[model samples]
Target chain A: MEQLKKAIRERGKVLSDEVLKVDTFLNHQVDTHLMAEVGKEFALRFKEDGITKVLTIESSGIAPSFMAATDLGVPLIFARKKKSLTLTDNLLVSQVYSFTKQQTNDISVSKDFLTEDDRVLIIDDFLANGQAAFGLIDIVKQAGAHVSGIGIVIEKSFQPGRVKLDEQGYRVESLARLHSLEDGKVTFLDETVSVQS
Target chain B: MEQLKKAIRERGKVLSDEVLKVDTFLNHQVDTHLMAEVGKEFALRFKEDGITKVLTIESSGIAPSFMAATDLGVPLIFARKKKSLTLTDNLLVSQVYSFTKQQTNDISVSKDFLTEDDRVLIIDDFLANGQAAFGLIDIVKQAGAHVSGIGIVIEKSFQPGRVKLDEQGYRVESLARLHSLEDGKVTFLDETVSVQS
Candidate 1:
């Protein structure tokens, strides 16, 4: 978490006081070493939950989520984004709205992978509006599986996402918590204050 | 490679004579342990290439690609697909046609990631038509970087992809080579015959 926060300060591009572009290392061009550390931390945090599977949405989340799954020795199920409106009986679908992209995508996972017997850990690159998390939660519930915990690489704490998930009784673990991205400055959340949440 | 061949024999679902789906492990729902093995194999195969970067496309390719980059002690750069035709000056773009999706996607990578001095190892989940590989190759060339080698999780040997890459003088190492998927059976290419290629 310390290294991630340091990387954000050094390499993260803060745009328009609201957008943080970590395309350099965190997402687009990934530093596998940092991601491995991230996976180790997430696995250490959620290993006690007896996680049978790690769930994540495709593209950006796959790197860290796959690493976490590797450390946990579990299978990783990545939800795919569908361009078409087609629905099948064998799949569980949910709509996720990305604030960054300003678009809604249909994310889905096959029902064959998840079951009531699985304990899932949902992992994602960022937790902004909780839209993606809610969508993944919907798919997990549709398959009758329980999400034991949620692991996030970056959390925009200035946003209402973490509060929303906490209100729903879901425990969220984020590696780097952003206090604010206001005025083109990267600010991190004080851990002592946020650990209670 | 033996385990990968066995996985293809056991868990792979043959959709048609040409289409083989390993969504159970290779993609979609991923087996991280197997992917870790895949990463180790790719790293071992390309260790002598002096690879500075491991290139892959978004979604399915990220898991094994990230692991390969991790083991190789290099960075993994994933090219993102753009739905819109808008191109930026600072990005390198290429068009990739997905044979399975029946769609053409514009895949782009940031210009800041790759440089003329870098040696890239291109990794992908499948090499059916070599469309994605070609697109990635374009981006690597645009960056003035050299592609040292290509690594594939599964290669559809019945297809002309390998021949095309070989003809282009690119060394390709595939973990599992499929001879054919005809008659609803997964047949692997004999190593003795394929090693000559």
Candidate 2:
């Protein structure tokens, strides 16, 4: 977690006061070594949850989720953002709004993948508005699966995402929590605040 | 490789004469253990090449590429299929036609990620027309980077992808090459046939 905060400070770019672009290491071009460490952090946090599966959205979340799933020794199911030719109709669908893209898209997972017997851990790269995570939780609930916990690489605590998930009674753990991005600078939540809240 | 072949034979579905869907393990829902093996296979094949970075497209390619990059002990950069707010204009872009979706999409990588000093190995989930790989190669070339080789999880040998890459003088190593998907039965190229040709 300290490594993640350090990476955010050293390599992360602040596009605007609201957007922190971690494409250098977190999303677009990834540091697999850092990702492995992030995965280990998540695995350590959720080791006793009896997680049967790891679920994440396509694209950005796959790498970290794959690493975590590998460490947790469970299968990973990524919810598809687009309905491809190979994706069948028997799927649990949910619409998610992307603040970065400024558009709404449908996300889906096959019914065959998630079942009532499965305990799902939803993972993502960044939690901003919580739309994507909420969408994934909706799909999991639709399949009658239990939501074990949520693991995030980076979170914008200034946003309402964390509070929203907490109000819904979900255990959310993030490696790095950003308190603010003001004047093209990133301010992280203190360790005590991050852990206590 | 044997594990991949066995997974295909057991779980792969022949959607049509041309489309063999292995979403059960290779893509959509991934078997992390098997993917680690696939990664090891790619690492063993290209271990001699000085691979500085592993490149692939987003979504499906992230899982396998992550494993391969982890095994190779390098950074992995995945080209973004769509332009997002976070992706800047300083990029090397190329167009790729997807036979599955029947659409052409622009793929781009940040100029900061790939440099002339970097030696890249492109990895993908499946190869049919070699369009995605070609596009990735184009971007890598645009950045003046050297491509060490290409690794694919599955290749449709009946298609022109393999021959096309061969004609272009790229070293391509696929874990499982399917000779045919005719009659709803999947047939794979023999070990000798796969290695020699």
List fnat per candidate, in order: 0.91, 0.91
lDDT of 2 by residue, A1-197 (tens): 89999999999989888899998887999998899899888988999999999999988898888878988999999999988898869999999998878889999999999999999999999998899999999999999999999999999998989999999999999999998899998898884344554
Off by over 4 Å in 1: A83-89, A191-197, B83-89, B191-197
Q: List the residue pairs that clash in candidate 2.
A: none
In angstroms, the error of model 2 at A125 is 0.5
lDDT of 1 by residue, B121-190 (tens): 9999989889999999999999999999999999999998999999999999999998989899888888
Interface RMSD of the candidates, in order: 3.3, 1.0
Please identify model 2 stretches exceeding 4 Å from their true place.
A191-197, B191-197
RMSD of 1: 2.8
Candidate 1, pairs of clashing residues = none
User: Tens digits of per-residue lDDT for model 1 on A1-197?
Assistant: 89988889998988766678888777889999998999889999998899999999888898888778988999999998873222245889999987767788899998899999999999999898899999999999998999899999999998999999999999999999998898898888874355554
